[model samples]
Target: MKPKKNPELEIGRNSSLYFAIGLNLMLFLSWQALEYKTYDKDFVAIDILNVDEELEEDIPIVNINTPPPPPPPPPVVVETITIVEDVEDVEETIIESTEANQNDAVEERIVDVSDVDVEEVDEDVEVPFAAIEDVPVFPGCEGEPRNKMKDCFQKKIQEHVVKNFRYPELATEMGIQGRVSVIFVIDSKGFTTKVRSRGPDKILEKEAERIISLLPKMTPGKQRGRSVKVSYAVPIFFKLQTS
Candidate 1:
């Protein structure tokens, strides 16, 4: 049984028509779903809002800080002095000082400083004594007529030696060693005068004078048959050669 195929029911021809219909339906539904999702995400309810309504709301406020005022400047101080005394008292004090100085000068002038005199006192020089000499008994003194005066001279000379002669003990004790020479005039009256030192030591000279002063007057020396006062020299030796 093979039946004849209808033209209208051909699979190939009807398949095209069914496919177009399905495509149209699927497109329409997809479009409608996309529109719905877009509208839901973006839409707002403007009709429910009340723009004119006044409502109280709490708002937070932030306060800014201000620095405190600077400290006050330090105080300024001033001092005052009052001088009450007059200058006249100071002037009087100065005048009194000057007057005192002038009065002191006038008093000094009245003092007699110039009237004082310094007297010079003269000093007495003590003449030191002389040394005694050892002499041999003078020869012609005993034999001649002039020898009559010998005894008198001997006593007088002894007295003179005792009174005027001084030993030079200092030289001997001090170990002083030297020679002293003396020059003197033997007068006609047999006295030694003007005794003076002719040697180095003046200390010995004094000693030499003491010795010469004790000498018995010498017989006047004859020169050209005339008796004349003669100058004579004597040397005294002081030594410690023994020790």
Candidate 2:
């Protein structure tokens, strides 16, 4: 037998629709509750000022007593000038010129070469090692040939440097090592002078200079058959050996 109640009006059929509407309404209420903000009741109270009431301030007036202006300056007195007449006669001075005129005779004197004194100035000439005609002779290298004198000189210099080279204690301890270029001048007297050195440190330079100063006296280099000063440069290397 068919049921008499209509299927469209059945309560169970509309239950899903009502449940969905109630779920949406519940979600909206939950969102509103989450979004609601609550302020603290312990807030600072601000006082409202009434614009109808006026504020009166009492300002005292001060009286300034200034000194009177200084009296006007006194009038300047003018002195009367008197005129005097000269009774004595004055003489005028005349300056005479000592300049020679065209009519004056000039005497001509002859200058003799014997009457004049000539001074001979000895100039100090410096010749470079490479450009010198004769290289300075070391004490032991005096027997070297003229053409081999340069090589002999260089060999002697190297031997001297090796014999006298001493590394500075300070430099060694501080690990300062470099090549020191020593520039020295061999004067006409064969003595080494004006020794200067440049290096990474002053200690190395001082050591190089000390070594150069110990060089033995040599025969002065010559240019044009005349003994002159010779300028030579040598580089002393400072190296630290690692074991």
Candidate 3:
């Protein structure tokens, strides 16, 4: 006799799989139910704005009275000119032309050199220290050779500056320090003049000029065997010593 149920076609063969799927579906549904949120219908409010029910505002109109423009300016009056007849006889003066024509002969005068007055104009000739044939001689540098006079002059100048250097009290207090360039001219009379200086500050410049002005009168420099003004420049240092 044939079996009522075949073992290969048993319904319980996939029972574990079906149980797992059903368990997973139940877990998902439980999680969704736990996360679900509900809002009260009474807590919600809906605002309905009726634009047609708005009140119309009427703005009051103000009338401004402006003053009328001023009256036009009065017309200008002109005086009438009258013609007057000359009762006395009038004589017209004629201007004679002084222009020379081809027929006119010009007088020639001879100029003699002896008759001509020659005014000698003493010109102020300035020669640079370097370009001068003879450099201004400092008092102590007279013993130096002519070839080495320039070096001696410079040495004497340095010595003089070192001896006469006095730091300005104001400049020192203000911490002003720099090199001041002093320019002065040794005139033909051997006197120092036109002493000017430029530096970082006016005080320094003034100090430098004072120092230059204190220089002793030197022997005037010569060019072409003639004494001339010699322009010389020196730099004075205003430095603060660091302790």
Residues 1-243, candidate 3: write the lDDT tens digits: 976877578788899999999999999999999999999999899999777766889998876786788999999999899999989998999999999999999999998999999897777899999899999999988878899999999998899899989999999899999999999999998999999888999999998898888889889999887889999999999999878
Which pairs clash (backbone N, Cα, C closer than 3 Å) in model 3? none
Between candidates 1 and 2, the TM-score winner: 2
The best candidate in terms of TM-score: 3
**In model 2, which regions exceed 4 Å deviation?**
1-102, 143-145, 223-227
Per-residue lDDT of 12 in model 1: 75
User: Candidate 2 vs candidate 3: which has greater TM-score?
Assistant: 3
**Residue 136 shift from truth in candidate 3, angstroms:** 2.1
Displacement of residue 232 (Cα, Å) in model 3 is: 1.1
Predicted candidate 1 versus true structure: per-residue lDDT over 44-82, tens digit per residue: 656665589778898878666868789999887777899
Q: What are the per-model C-alpha RMSD values against the true structure?
A: 35.1, 13.3, 13.2
Pairs of colliding residues, candidate 1: 130-207, 130-210, 131-207, 190-217
Clashes of each: 4, 0, 0
Cα-based lDDT at residue 71, candidate 2: 100
Model 2: lDDT of residue 142: 77
